[model samples]
Target chain A: MKLLSTCSLRKVRGRNLLIVPDPCSGNPDRILEVTDSFAWLVGHFKEDVFTVKTLAIALSERYGLDDDTAAKEAANVIQIWQDYHLIEP
Target chain B: MAGLSPDRALTLLFPLLRLSLWGTPLPDAVKQETRLLNESDWEVLISVAKNQSVTGLLFQAVDSLPEDIEIPDKTLVQLAVMADRIEASYRRISTASEIVLTELRNEGLNPVVMKGLSCASWYPRPELRQSGDIDIYLPKLPTKSGRHFQTSPDGSLHFQQDGVDIDIHSRYFDIHHHTEYLPSVPSPEAEWMMISLHILKHATTSGVGLRQICDAALLWKILPDNSKASLPIIFKATHTMRWHLLLFSFLEDYFHIQNPLRHISSKPLLSIIAHGGNFGHHSTSRSRLLKAPSFIRKADTAFRFLLRIPFSLRFAPREILPTIKELTTGNLQHAFTADSHSILH
Candidate 1:
């Protein structure tokens, strides 16, 4: 399957959140967000997951964060989104 | 030249060089040209030489280029190694695409090989472009399981080929809006029509910056459009028309986007949609409704969740009127902008 895009969480309401597709995502319209931290991205989005280390490296370049910080933040947000039923896992 | 940074020049030229070496059988002159490199180019050449694969060498050379060019020799050696590896990888991919096409044909499936493979084959000079993997578009119905035919229990489809991967799709997107509008048209029997739809759909949804899409569109325009023309015969060859309709419908709702038919000639897309072809459904994480099997599953959910918000917001931009206007009317030249370097294989 073609990968449409990727996104990240941004807080919206007090506890509610909004998910935003990364502008850099190749296909920006493939998935929809349920909340800031979660979305209904794709059926096989799980298959494309990168490790925290890998994600950190990728995010660091775009977000201006260091690798360790990027990894930790990504891991925390991912875990929270998963628990919230926003993502597939 | 005045505006281009050394890093940017390296970034663009490196891929050109790698693709040229890989897809084209370079003469000794070109090989020598590669060997005699400038300080920046030398870094890339050395990186390719050290790395075993040309693709890997290209990536390494790109990665090792100094943000500021203080250390030249070390970088040049690194680049040479990478260049060598990239050259090898390109050859492997070209060979692999032919093999995969043959295998698919042997299985009685007519695969309209997409992306890099098609580009390499159809382009005037294949060596000028680099491709990561072979993307083959096959017209098939998803099983009742609602997944690609080859997806394993782990959700990864492992093809036997090395340094090459496959992404098979029953539909172009998870959300496609126009399935219901064209339920009466018959399924396409000809290879050219099917391939044309594939290329058209890709171009409409992704916009134009992608070289692969342009290649597909160009090739499709040149290919003959006539073949068999019978519903029963087409159905027998492929799956039922209902499956296609459902797949298209599902894509419409899932992505929350309109049909790509708007961008292309309406006749063919209308025909495809008129047939019982539907889009795929919005991909909700099964893990969300059940226990996920792995960390990848969880990560997938998280990523999707993040994506859904913007997708929804974009679908209903009026709700966020100011941001919508700013984005839509802003100076941004492209509808979608991505860090292409990050996705390089």
Candidate 2:
């Protein structure tokens, strides 16, 4: 079985950090407390296609937020994180 | 299939129950009964059948009849009594094995028995050590020599009496590359060294816990100083402590067994550190190491290293990593199936 990259995007002290280096760089970025939901989304999906439905479920569980609000907020935050290059498509 | 006789079934069931309680899964009834058994009762049965051949009446007392399919109350009581006897036997065998190992050394045969026997002789208490088979290490040619060795036609070691199983190994790590690190040393010296390395590697890398390393250190302390000369052979056989250390580091970073390094008594940990190759400081806690993210990296590195070993000397890396993962993750059904396909051929 192939070993998959586990690096993910995180927020350390309010600054968005990429915990893992891009594969091309061979050095990982250091971020703090980037919840598994964020990591899973970033690791498995392209940022451009990261949907509100997926973000909602992930955020609801990740931050203990109620469903509809979490969905709305996660979609917005994911777009912002993407715009900031905290995650790559 | 040959169905077990009632008496034989009881004999099998008692230990199976204990093993299940130890960690293996078992039927609800058996689990319930096992929970009712006190630690002392558990100790008793383990002690009796550990290393002796008991026949006739004592056997009958512990044995149940095939006609009675279920485990009878009388049989259970007998089992409790037998547990004490078995535990005593475990101790006696451990002591005797220590003596026998010394004799084997005198005969110029390097011998190291693994698992429970090692635990009984090396661990704090016989009961704490549980093993179903005897794993012995036999030193052959080094991996660098480009030679492969197998057990003799008669087998490396095999003898059976009553119903107990006895197995002997001339090698460890069914894959050839891993076995290559084993080098022939002068008898008991080799045994002691192998056991120490096994404990160290398992504790540090596999995250199996600190108890094993503690046991190894205890054994090292108790063994006569005359065996000290053999310590170098372990390094030579395994090609320095780097491989084991790296292996442990990788495992710790990935699998997250435990950091006995932190929990273990200072004295033994100090002893290991003083020896100085591969044993070093690790900053991460056990929990971080167990998560999938860390494990993937660690496993990847370990897998890469195994791949770099000379192919001729190596077993299929493709097979080893998955098997190790399955085994470590407690997927025994899959692990056994994978093991049969990879090793049996």
Candidate 3:
């Protein structure tokens, strides 16, 4: 999954947020709070797409965690981001 | 008065900002004071930075302090977050500016971008500078009449475009009605003169802010030696040589730039900036004057004008009467006049 072209990650008022511009003029821009780890994960995929397996591998390398543990964590974070419509498959 | 005898925040913030904007070596006294800042002091410093529209610059300074310097992790995080948000906003404004500029060019108008984006280009990371409305100078457009004829007397036409405000100016400088001293449009000489006069205009009226002064300082630092030598003569032609010296000297002291200009009385101007924050939004009487009854508002405005008289007289005496005339006549004529005929959206 990759971040939507129109969406971006920004830290708003001290909170990490996934900013998605609203399509409707009457609606406000969507701001979804993201965890620090999730923001770090997003940084790695800024120029490319990533799947749970790739994220897990990257996370394992960065944090020196076992592959199984990293994969579960990556899948959980990615699921939340997908639900928020920040990620496009 | 408040800025003259600055409180704790200004004391620490001044040196930190100098370190941030230029790589000026921090004084021992300043470093010690910074180390002693409590959490509350940090909050005040952050507030001042935000109010002055220099959060990203302050963040860089704070982040680059020596290893032994003990800024709380939470403070660092706050500054970082705010800086990120400012940069994000700058990106939006930059894209919007490009769209507006392209559309103006498509319409056969030669729009020379002034202030906002132009100043940002001098910074190491242009995206980190605080962005505002785009000010474009259209030399071809006549001040008296144009496609956008609803412009203010000062030759500015404002409209919303590409989700950002665009101010089209038919004239380069707002200091004087006459352009006898100014050279041809689109030249570097005229641009620098315009920037200096813009700062003087604000300083003599509502009040100048640190951001504009920082812009002038950064722009001055990059100018060639010959260009620097030529500026005094241009300012002299416009009868603003005194103001030019005062401003550059102040910048030299504040930003600690190399080759200091001859010292002058910059305290008054510094006080104005410290009190005004960004565009006088943080002036002591601003909120009170805004929410007061009509009579009280008038009184407050008069009082503020009186306070500004001495500074105006010292810096740019030619502007005092014009400012007074503006105050009395009121400038309610030019608000978002090009809405129906916006150049772009």
What pairs collide in candidate 3? Answer: none
Q: Tens-digit lDDT track for model 2 on A1-89?
A: 11123343433223233344446743443333455455555655543455667767777876789987897787676665655455544
Across B110-173, the per-residue lDDT of candidate 1 in tens digits comes to 6665445655555443543345566666666222221222342312232435546555544432
Clashes of 1: 81
Go through the candidates in order and give the C-alpha RMSD of each one to the true structure: 22.8, 25.7, 5.9
Query: In terms of TM-score, how similar is model 3 to the real structure?
Result: 0.78
Instruction: Highest DockQ: give the candidate number.
Output: 3
Instruction: Give the top-scoring candidate (lDDT).
Output: 3
Q: Each model's fnat?
A: 0.00, 0.00, 0.07
Docking class of 2: incorrect
Tens digits of per-residue lDDT for model 3, B7-98: 56765666877777777768998878777776667787888777777777888788667766787756765676666666766887788888
Ranking by DockQ: 3, 1, 2
Docking class of 3: incorrect
Candidate-wise lDDT, in order: 0.38, 0.41, 0.70
- Can you tell me which runs of candidate 2 are displaced by over 4 Å? A1-89, B1-115, B122-129, B136-161, B172-188, B200-211, B224-237, B243-345
Q: How many pairs of residues in model 3 come into backbone collision?
A: 0
